[model samples]
Target chain A: NAGVTQTPKFQVLKTGQSMTLQCAQDMNHEYMSWYRQDPGMGLRLIHYSVGAGITDQGEVPNGYNVSRLNKREFSLRLESAAPSQTSVYFCASSAGGTGVSYEQYFGPGTRLTVT
Target chain B: LAKTTQPISMDSYEGQEVNITCSHNNIATNDYITWYQQFPSQGPRFIIQGYKTKVTNEVASLFIPADRKSSTLSLPRVSLSDTAVYYCLVGPDYGGATNKLIFGTGTLLAVQP
Candidate 1:
């Protein structure tokens, strides 16, 4: 299984430009999440999905949007890129149960640079 | 979601055991403490997790006290490869609207020879 895979390992966007970050998991997890990590800092959740066709805002969801059209795919979209949005983005999936089943599997991460 | 506090950085020598502790004063009854290790330019990986007592895995061990207010992650026989940022997260284990995981600044571990 691929666990979780993200597209475009690295991307550079200009001010006001928009882009979508794609995340897919073959582990058939019911929960998926998008997080951003700044230099020397831990990850902050941007958005998450409990299941297909369900998405919700997270701690830092102001500048982002998300969609989960299917159980295997979760996408994070930036409507207007800003320099502050420049950071490494990661996608994770979990089995969506209690206890140890909540262990999340992360993707390789995408490095975004907004100029 | 409970907030977690941990050391900013720690230094250790190779072959020595390293323990990183996290404090979560407002941990809820259903919340579980989990640890993740992040390397440079990579994604964070799960190390260990536990609610009470101890949880041992091949990579690390997680120890939680009776109160579940604080937890420790023990890494045995560390190497230079073990150098990374460790994050302690407290969240509910069940899936629902509150199934989000919050990450703090994390503790950076630097292993020396």
Candidate 2:
């Protein structure tokens, strides 16, 4: 299986620009999450979905939005990208939700730069 | 979410055992300690997790004290490929949000071959 995959491996955006980063998992996992890694910082949760049609805000959800249209996809949208928004974006999936026992599988990560 | 404190960095030699300790003094009684390993350009991967006592897997071993306030991730043999940042997370092991993990500043383990 392909596990979790994210699109747009690299992107360079100008301030005020908008873009959507796509994520998908073949594992049929019921949980998906988005996180951003800043320099010298730990990953911060952006948004998450427990299943298709169920979404929730996470620790750092101010600059982003997410939707779970189908079970296999969880896309992150950055509206009005700012220089502070530049960071590595990662998509992860887990086997279950509500204290699921399995480990989280992550994507390679998308390198984003807002100049 | 309980806060976790781990060494910002560590250095290890090849073939040596590396144990990275993490402290979570305020860990909730039901919280579980989970460890994740992240490469320079990748997402964090789950290494091991435990609530109490020790849990061993092929990748690493997680040692949690009876009080559940601390945990140690033991890497049996160090190698160049093992050099990466390790994250310690604390949360309910079951019956909580599946992916609401609080990843704090993790320990950067540098293994020199």
Tell me each candidate's TM-score.
0.93, 0.95
lDDT of each: 0.89, 0.88
What are the interface RMSDs of all the models?
Answer: 2.9, 2.6
Q: Candidate 2: misplaced stretches above 4 Å?
A: A98-102, B96-99
lDDT of 1 at A91: 95
Per-residue alpha-carbon lDDT of model 1 for A3-110, expressed as tens digits?
A: 899998999999999999999999988888899999878788888888999887778999899999999999999999999999999999888632232788899999
After the best TM-score superposition of candidate 2, give how far the Cα of residue A32 lies from its true spot, in angstroms: 0.9
Stretches off by above 4 angstroms in model 1 are A97-101
Q: Write one digit per residue (lDDT tens) for candidate 2, span B1-113.
A: 78889999999999999999999899887787888899888888888878799999999999888887888899998889999999998887674364377778799999886
lDDT of 2: 0.88
Q: Find the candidate with the highest lDDT and give its number.
A: 1
Model 1 chain A: which ten-residue window has the lowest total lDDT? A95-104
- Scoring only the A-chain of each prediction against the true A-chain gives TM-scores of 0.95, 0.95
Cα displacement (Å) at residue A31, model 2: 1.2
